[model samples]
Target: MKPLYNFILSAIGATLLSGCASSPDHATAGHDAAAIMPASGGPLLPLPGESLVPAHDPDDGLFMDALSSWLEQNNAPPNTQYEFTRIDLDNDGRREGLVLMQSPHQAWCMEYGCSLFLFRAHDDGFSYLSEISPVRGPLVVAESQTSGWRDLIIHVSGRQNNDARNVALKFNGRGYPSQPASAPGLAMNMLDVTGVKIFP
Candidate 1:
């Protein structure tokens, strides 16, 4: 009886120690997940009135209503199609905004193809930057390490049949892309000039 009691106590002690050891690991795993998950259920921008062909059919009326309310409040103007492509460009957990507009002047340039606009959610509100025209399949952000600085790269492509072009826009301390020192030496490509700092 005495030996049996000792064995039971030993087993209980081992279980407790194992649980203590795993507690920290479990906590750390949770922290990592939280850091990677985008913020959900925030106040989204309102949808415009003329009604958008829902990115998904059988639209959720509640979402549409909230979107409509946002559009009216922001005065987004007529004939602008706002598409929220939830992409986390900056890796900030919160998804950034991708707006596609089909204005007559702008629309004509694309010839009915969609124009891509990226917006970063700022403390005050959403800030719209340049129209991203890809030289390849799609314009994507690339980062690289140079001699003594890091570069924020943007690739812009021309029309469908054109070879994919490259534009290396550098960024500095505050995280904005710097202007190209010289011409990209490529024709029919747009460079980022949004005053984003560029590192040498």
Candidate 2:
């Protein structure tokens, strides 16, 4: 009987210690240095149908869900980080989605550098239009519509090799590889060009 009692007491003590260890610390629980406890925030309420919501707001659960679905569909390799930039590429008073994927140190060598993907949201869902390669640092996209078709102009640069770099100016439409132009020179390395016109 004595042995059983000791074992029971030890098990109880272990359970108590584990519970306390899993709980968040007071500092992390939003308590200040003065030890004043914080109040419980209000509950979250869903927006009504047809409510006006900003597209880029992270708090919007619908937008977050859609973005997550897109990311998962792309199947980004492990250790790759993506930065999304929103711009009005079409200049139609609506913002377009531009995603820049970079590999910090991944097994895929081609993904180690930079890649750009352009997307536009529609009534059904977002549509992926084109993808460009050798896109290094920051990216800026602008729209140039001529005749009855829309053209997306993308500017990207990256270190091609030791002591040598490359910058490419490409365009895509409903059809891809329609417009291709490139310039390479040692002095032009890393220099930002205002805009390069792509001829189809």
Candidate number with greatest lDDT: 2
- RMSD for each model, in Å, please? 22.8, 18.8
lDDT for model 2, please. Answer: 0.34
Candidate 1 local lDDT, residue 114: 47
Model 1: lDDT of residue 96: 42
User: Could you estimate the TM-score for every candidate?
Assistant: 0.34, 0.45
lDDT of 1: 0.31
Badly placed stretches (over 4 Å) of model 1 are 1-77, 103-115, 122-125, 129-137, 143-164, 168-200
Residue lDDT tens for model 2, 5-53: 1000001111111112123212211112222111211122212232332
| Residue 71, model 2: Cα distance from true site in angstroms | 2.6
Which pairs, if any, clash in model 2? Answer: none
Total clashing pairs in model 1: 17
